[model samples]
Target: MARVSQEHLDARRRQILDGAAICFARNGFHATSMQDVLKEVDLSAGAVYRYFSGKEALIAAIVEEVLGQVRDGFEEAALSSPPPPPDLLVSSVLGRVLESKEFLTVDGRPAFPRLVVQVWTETLRNDQLAGILHDGYSAVQKTWGRIVEAYQDTGMMRSDISADRVARTMMAAAMGFLAQQALFGPAPHEILRDGLRALMSVRDPYDTTGGSQLG
Candidate 1:
C-alpha cells in the first residue's frame, strides 16, 4: 500500500474534527453520539476512531487550541517593548479568542465558546476534563503573571501587589467576560475597556496620609 502523506493525514483529522465540532455545537457533547459525528463527516467508524477515541478527546483538542490562543496573546504582549495596559491587555486577549478560526464553525459562527460552556458544566463530573482545564488555566496564569511583572517594571501598576494575585485577578475578570460573551450576544470590546478604566480611575478620597492609590 502507498503511504499516505502527512498532509493527507492532517486533512483527514481536520475533517473529522470539524464534523465533530458541528455536531457538538448543535446538539452538545452528551446528546451527540459518535455515530452522529461519523454521519456528519460521512466517515466510517474506524476512520473517525483513528483520529479521536471519543468526545472527551475531541473536547481536549478544542480546549487546547483555545488555551494556546490565550497564551499566545499574553506571551506576545509580555514580550513587547511596552506591555499593554491591564485593560488593553484584557480586551485584546478576549478579542483574540473571539476571532480565532479554530473556534469558528462551518457557518462562520464561534462554536467553541458555547462548547466550552458545556465543557464547564461537564467538568463537574469529569475529572479528566477538570484536570485539563486546570492545567490550561495554570499555564495561562503563569504567562499572565509575567505580564504583570512587565507592567510593574514599567511603573504601570503597583509594585507592592503580588504578581500572582494580580494575574489571577485579571484572569478571573477576563474569564468572566468570556462567559458573559458566550451566554449573551457579542458586545463591544470597548465595554470591557471602559469598565476597566472606570475601575482603575477610582480615587481613594478618604486617604489623607500619603499612600499608594492602589491603581
Candidate 2:
C-alpha cells in the first residue's frame, strides 16, 4: 500500500475534523460515536481509523480547530490595532459566538452550551485535553497581556497594575459573562461594554480617539 501525501492527509484530516465538530457540537463529545463521525463525513470505517484512532482523538482535534481559530482571531485583532481596546477584544471574541446562530438562540441562549460544558468538563478529566486547551488559552492570554502592556506604555492603561494580572482578570470576567450568557438571555455586548468601562475607570480617562491629542 502506498503512503498518502501530506497534502492529501491534511485535506482528509480537515474533512474529518469538520464533520467531527458538527457531530460533537450536536451529539456531544461523550455521546458521539466514531461511526457517527464517519457517517457525517461519508468516510469508510477503515478510513476513519486511518485518520483518528478513536473518538477521543477526534474530539481533541475538533477542540484544537475551534481554539486555533480563536487564537488566530486574537492575534489578528492585536496586530490590526497597535494597542487594541478591551472592548474590541471582547466584541471580536463574543462576536464569533453570536455569529453562530446554530449555537445561539434569538434571545442569546447558546444552542450548544451543553457541548461546550462537556468539552470543558472532559478537559478536567483528561490531562492531555487539559494541556491542549490550556496551552491554547495561555497563548491567547499572553497576546492580550502584550496588548495590555503596550497600552500601558502608551499611557492608556493604569501604571500601577500588572499587565498579566489585568489580562487574567479581564479574561475571567469575559469567561464568566459568557457562561452567564449561555445560561441567560442577556446581550453579551452590552454586559461587556459596561464591564469594560468600569474596568478602564482605574486608569485616567482616555477618550475613544485612539489616544490622539488629549485636551
TM-score of each: 0.86, 0.73
List where candidate 2 sits over 4 angstroms from the true fold. Answer: 1-12, 97-113, 185-191, 198-215
Model 2 collision count: 1
In terms of lDDT, model 2 sits at 0.71
Model 1, position 37: C-alpha lDDT score:
87
**Highest lDDT: which candidate?**
1
Candidate 1: C-alpha RMSD to true structure equals 2.6
Best by TM-score: 1
Residue lDDT tens for model 2, 109-179: 44444455567878878999999889988997998787787777777765567788988887777676766
Residue pairs with backbone atoms closer than 3 Å in model 2 (clashes) = 103-111
Q: Rate the local accuracy (lDDT) of all candidates.
A: 0.80, 0.71
Please give the lDDT score at residue 60 for candidate 2: 78
Worst 10 residues of 2 by lDDT: 101-110
Looking at model 1, which ten-residue stretch has the lowest summed lDDT? 100-109
Query: Considering only N, C-alpha and C atoms within 3 Å, which residue pairs clash in candidate 1?
Result: none
